[model samples]
Target: MTPPRDVAVVAYARTDHQGPAEGLSEAETLLPVLHEVLDRAGLAPGEADFTCSGSSDYLAGRPFSFTLTLDAVGAWPPIAESHVEMDGAWALYEAWVKILTGRADTALVYAHGKPSAGDPRDVLTRTLDPYYLAPLWPEPASLAALQARALADAGHTAGPDPAADPLAGPPAVADGAAAVVLAAGDAARRMCGRPAWIRGADHRVEPHALGLRDLTDSPSTRLAAERAGAFRAPVDTAELHVPFAAQDVVLRRALRLDDTVTVNPSGAAAGPLMVAGLIRLGEAAARIHRGASDRALAHATSGPCLQHNLVAVLEGDA
Candidate 1:
């Protein structure tokens, strides 16, 4: 089969992460970020060949919540647009495929969430096994702690007490939005001095039953990383989307990261839902764009206990 077209991230912008965005509507939250990324990429609104978004309607307490941001970027005159209910990173994956398939030359991707508006624990519980786990109403921290405890018993250090540490637990859910701009080939080079070319990217999911999986090892993450070409060459930096600090150990082991690789310099903390993953990729790309890194790896996770994973290997032009 022919190789996919080379895709590169050209620009990125993120809002200030906070506990609550009470006064700002989704459109207000996205307008500035949309402008910044496009400006950085030298694109005006509706200029990109395609636009995609990642956001959860549950987070917004309405269906089709993502469409609310469309006007912020000027959807008038009609543009190729789509949305994902998952993290912006996945939306980025869709955009990557869009560019790879020759469907579009450029794409704008973004995501947002406001966990403070409702009971996040209750909302998260709904994502579990409907017949078995959802009834238990397990808060995300307890579930992560269970995995962290299991990992520690297997020799990895225990993550911070899931309920005790607000920063490492459910309370850390950041309320913010982020955006990234992607372009192909010379257009990418023309926009950014050092485009962070996506060498490979892949996502994988494991058995949804938590009891059926091993908490100490991230098989899905390992498989995704391998398929994404992370093992083909050593990466100098890694931006990991670990919900709990302890989970970092699992990702490191899975990705074969060494001491030479710097991790998470942006200090995402708990990271905004549906947005942190995109930030990881953007942060990794920013490092490459500024000549701080030659090669890097970025990761994102969905579902509980790293049950679903996405990994991408990125390299800067020599």
Candidate 2:
């Protein structure tokens, strides 16, 4: 069977790097970027054929946080929309699927989270299996530490003191929001001056049980990257959602990205958050627009110990 035609990311936007974005509701934090993305795409809110968003109610200390953000979209006439309790990158996947199915020619995707509202480390316990794991209070960091140790023992990582531990180093939590506008073929041409054609995109999930997984290699990420067709096509840059420093190294190996590929020029100063993965997409698109890179790969991760992952390969026209 012939592969589906490529879709394009026409525009993207993100909020200022800030801590705990207090005093503003989720709607408030998301509204400006929503409008900015529309404007960047040269389209109106009502023009999108479909809309999807990613967010977590637990982070907001309340449920249905995404429903309120609908007000920002002015959904009076109603629109095709969906929500994921995952990151915005997953929402981008949903949007891409919508376009691929011939159901929608244009889509708006957004994601937000307030990691500052609660003790992020403590709250991460909810991601664990409630019946068997939650009671143990295995925070996300500790689980990551287990994986790091496993990698170290397997020689996938360095450092003589394998038992010294890695998670005790530092935390990478932050707060932010991000949005992107996508369109297909002619619709994409009308939306932006320079659209980054999405050559391929794919995501994968590993078993929830930590013991059942291999820590030395992220099979899920490798599977997703392979499905994304990035390895088949040349990639000039890779914007990966690596919150922890060590995970960056792990992902590089999993994706088979060499030093020639530009990685995370944003650095720790940018303060990545839940929307970081989506921001990577936006950053790649920006590189295309600026002619800084011709082809790029963007990746996002979800769940504890990188149990879930997504990858998208993007390219530009000369």
Among all windows of 10 consecutive residues in model 1, the one with the lowest summed lDDT is 158-167
N/CA/C clash count, model 1: 0
lDDT: worst 10-residue window of model 2: 157-166
lDDT of predicted model 2: 0.80
lDDT per residue (tens digit) for residues 1-318 in model 2? 112976899998988855777687777888999999999898887789999998888876787767988988878788889998888888998898889989999999998887887887788888788888888998766777777767767776642243334566546566778899999998887777778988888889999887788777799899888888888977988888865555765788899888698886555412444687788888888888777889999888888877898989888877
Q: Please write out the lDDT profile of model 1 over residues 124-161, one tens digit for every residue.
A: 88899999999999888889878777876787654344
Please give the lDDT score for candidate 1: 0.86
Clashing pairs in 2: none
